[model samples]
Target: MGYSPSVHKFAEGADVPVPLDLELVRAVLEPHDVGDPRLCFDPDGDLQFWIRAGDGSEAEIFAGDTGILVERPHSGGVFGIVAELVSRLGAVAVDPSEGRIVCSTEEYAHLPVSMRKDAVVIEMTGERLEAALLGRRPA
Candidate 1:
């Protein structure tokens, strides 16, 4: 099967709370030995982490108030990593092609019923990063 990249979108509301525990996140990544993950802030002030995979490819996970943005090269193991995160962190997978939430965890059982309209949109781009560092949105 070909690899399909998807973003794990955390739903907002009283029922589906976003996981903000960075230590838990680090713990989940420990088994993979992702090294000492570096934390950074995005343009919108969301927390992000840079993790080095076993194969040395860099994978980025941006933790927003309501969701997480994962950016990885077309490497083979990203899907598994995402799955692991879903299993450990209770994330909902949003299929990139369909632009909808496809799966839910036990903690987010209400997700499937929530529909696509509720899925949070998270965009991570180099221009956004540059603008954030410069303290201005790119024109």
Candidate 2:
């Protein structure tokens, strides 16, 4: 099934906090005519689709397989847990913001020289990643 009409309507040239819907991602990239049908993982171990269009262009889109991975920025302890989880899942942690988990097959390819305080920039697309930073721990 495709994304709800409301979801498409909401996504129309807008950025919002919506769980990664597999169907919607497929529909959104089909028009692009990218590559062959393939599945990949994001930074969070969530499933994603890789479409190989006619022109051989490739598009990577998130599939909402995994539910809300991390609501807020993860702390050292929590972050370690996530890391371990990904490792066990046979994936790697990409970004905490999007909760991008990817397989070893998918290399980082590139990464920013440094992530800014409270800001993450996707090295590939050069887009700023926004996610709530891990909150302070109580004394």
TM-score versus the correct structure, for each prediction: 0.53, 0.24
Model 1 regions more than 4 Å off: 1-19, 30-45, 104-108, 112-139
Residue-pair clashes per candidate, as listed? 0, 18
Q: Which residue pairs of candidate 1 clash?
A: none
The model with the greatest lDDT is 1
- lDDT by residue (4-41, candidate 1, tens digit) is 33344344434454555556655655565443434355
Candidates' C-alpha lDDT = 0.50, 0.31
- On a 0 to 1 TM-score scale, where does candidate 2 land against the true structure? 0.24
Q: What C-alpha RMSD separates each model from the true structure?
A: 11.6, 15.9
Candidate 2 local Cα displacement, residue 54, angstroms: 51
